[model samples]
Target: MSTPDTVTVDGPGLRDDPSRPGPVDVPALLAHSRETVGPALRAAVARLDVSSREQAEYHLGWVEADGSPGRGGGKAVRPALALLSAAAAGAPAETGLAGAVAVELVHNFSLVHDDLMDGDRERRHRPTVWARWGAASAILCGDGLLTLATEVLLEDRSPHAAAAARLVAVTTRELIRGQAEDVAFERRADVGVDECLTMAAGKTGSLLATSAAIGAVLAGAPTAAVRGLSDYGMAVGMAFQLVDDLLGIWGDPAVTGKPVLSDLRSRKKSLPVTFAVQRGGAAGRELAAWLAHTGEQTDAELRAAADLVERGGGREWAGAEARRRMVAAERALAGAGLAAGPHAELLALGHHLIDREF
Candidate 1:
């Protein structure tokens, strides 16, 4: 974990930090978010059919594949976003608890379905929901989560309840659209940069944007403040996905908890890969040929493909683009009118999102 006084990345966009007492402690914030959101998810799942409930619980890491107690989960970024956004809007963080749980449920809903669609056998170093519970159960579990996300919001009975639910629904639709495009891209050989960016914004950016905005809306923030939070989330979300794409090619398997070149192995059309192809250089040509092959690539071939991606400037371009997005995020956050504490925490969180190793 990075200390508040940690010397972070310095560039045109990222502001220098002297010391902070809030969002710099990412691990602590994540733990706090999980504590708030986890029980809500568990209770919601408990209301479902017994078998489906078990599957959902397993997927959520509340239990093992064999129904034993276990501990495993994501970094809780979405929940933290909701809580922080509420604080930024001058509301108590507890007021956003429902919003945070809804966002976490929706996020896990996407994960369950994505694993099935991608034929991914593992997630968080465990067998994926589909891999362990079968496709039917996995699909049901995902449906259950989506239902719970809306149900939690509807149960709130607050003035912004309907609006928040609407936001989540709209974002979920975009997510589905992005997933459709991603599947279609796998079958085509000519995916362009613009299309890839659109897909990324929908699949990854929309939920995160909504996550950051919902808390503000629930807190009855002014319209401009809510919009600012939304824009900040969108920018950070794009930057986050870009970093993820970079890590897919070059990150250590131990740190990422995945196989080497996992994205390449899956033939994912990640941002860096798109940039490499768009460059149309010798390295791009070489990479295009490797991408054309349908057979499973050897480890050596995967290494060569990664080399081509980096040599073609994909790595540098993505890093720069991410930093630019970070700058955009900072600008939007500045307009959110948050108190110093929330604003500083959000800035730190934004920097952490871009500068993380895994």
Candidate 2:
């Protein structure tokens, strides 16, 4: 949330032409998005019963477990993307505020449930809703958030609201499917990189795709342009997950709010891990054997496993793939006919997100 502004956009985009956009302040864009949609998001959550409201507020980083005031939510990237989509269509950013709130709601809803399902005890350096409260409470809270997401959009009187709501529903289904696949992968050692990439496309890409295009739907942008933005969002989402997979293995706990090599410790068949295992070399075999073992790994073992993943080319592959996806995102944006400023903003954001470090 405290990230700096002034992101220099990489990747080929409309900015390549001398008459087009300049550097975008991604942090300012994100901050403006938060200012635009955070209240709507909170007000929507306020509709939940008190029991659910407290848990929602806590999990949303609005308060501490003891109900004390606190400040920390994610970078609010989804909402930012939604609002930017509308701007790209030459509409008032406010036209996309509902879409922004709805996507943010669904995102947080998934986070609550995902934390419970993954047995993750911490988020944003605080105890997760399930860990601090109870699993039952966490489930109900997630349900409340998910329901509110649709309700918020449906409450809008815009002619396009229904279509946007429907899109959110469909995208949420894909997200759930991807999550299921991710969970199932834990029980099998035969997960392939292609399969893992497909899973990431669903789990992460679908929602982002919606976030990118839903604003256009709400603003009634041309169908082809909306489709282009959706395509751009998909590529950006894949890049994001690849970077996440890398962070899961090598992120700084002080920044990521999780232990180092956390995914390896859990034996998570992440994209990079899957790629490395499928690479089939000495390092790959060692990594596969380590993953197959059903015992808690030592600190040394975790570090060594991280090395094996790198040696097996998982780290390099993930990094290169992330860059490739960024390029794809830019290409999609170039043909989208988006307004120059918004197009520039979107491209800068994609770069900033995929290039993010923990």
Candidate 3:
């Protein structure tokens, strides 16, 4: 668990310290979100068929491959965001439980498919579902999770359930479109910054936007508030992806759960790499030439590529862009009609996503 540079946890429970000024105790906030959402999530998973259930249980870190107690569940960022958005709309966090579980299911669905598509055999220090079982099981698990994400929302009795469900369907399409663009970019040498931003908006931003908006929609928030929350989530998501790109090239492998310079090794034209490629400096030219090589890249070669990305101004630009997006997120929330506490927490969480090395 990493803390943003702006928040602290020196108070009782979820309350902030009165002496210092910042967001509430975020660790506590997230823990509360996870606790609040866990039973519903588990109930949904329990409804799955045996094979799918086993894979979901393992992948969600609720149980080990051997069915023992374990933990690999992610940070619960989506769920926390959903719950906070509910509160922002003047409802209790539990009012957003369905949305929280739905977004989380969608997120895990994407992760299962991502690992298989990337041929990644490990995640959270465990064998990936495909590696442990087989590709068929992994595929089935992802399908089951995606189906459940919609069912969760539809099953809700709220008057807004239908609209929220529709948003989920639309967001999923956008997510897949983004994923398709990402896969296509992996093979092309001419990925531009604008298209990359567009891809990221879909791949990462849409789901997050839904997570922030669906809860409020379920609570029947006014349209302007919902739109502001959605915009805030999108800005935060974009900043999150930019920071993730930096981590891919320069973060500690132990912290990132990927090898050092993993993006460079795979020749991924991430935002930073795209910036470098478009800069057209000597370092950028060398990086472009090296990326054109379709053969395996050595560790030394990967290090040199990271160097080129930095020298070409990619690294600095990414950091600056992330900060810029965070600023935009703050602006988006100015008139959001959010509860003061939840609003502060939302801003804190967004900063946390970009500020941490992980």
Q: Of the candidates shown, which would achieve the greatest TM-score relative to the real structure?
A: 3
RMSD per model, one decimal: 4.4, 4.1, 3.0
Candidate 3 ranges beyond 4 A from true positions: 1-23
lDDT of 3 by residue, 1-358 (tens): 2335455333222233434555476677788888889999999999999999999999999999887897758889999899888878878766788999999999999999989988999998899999999999999999999999999999998899989889889999999999999999888888888999999999999999889888899999999889999999998999899999999999999888788999887778899999898884899889899889888878998998999999999999998988888888888887787777677778777776777764
lDDT of 1: 0.81
Sliding window of 10 residues with minimal summed lDDT for model 1: 9-18
Put down candidate 2 lDDT per residue, 92-123, tens digits, no spaces: 66788899999999999999999999998988
Residue 307 displacement (Å), model 3: 1.7
Residue-wise lDDT of candidate 1 within 1-358, one digit each (tens)?
1324232322111122323332245566567677777777678778889887887778778888776897876778888888778878888776677788888889989999999998989888799989987999999989988998999998985689888999999999999999999999988877887899899999989988988888888888999889998999899899988999998988888877778998898777799998898785998888887888888889998998888899888889888888888889889988778756666667777667777684
Q: Cα miss at 73, model 3 (Å)?
A: 1.0
lDDT-superior candidate, 1 or 3: 3
Q: Under the 3 Å rule for N, CA and C atoms, how many clashes does model 1 have? A: 0
Ten consecutive residues with minimal summed lDDT in candidate 2? 10-19
Prediction 3 TM-score vs. true = 0.93
Give the TM-scores of the predictions, in the order they appear: 0.92, 0.92, 0.93
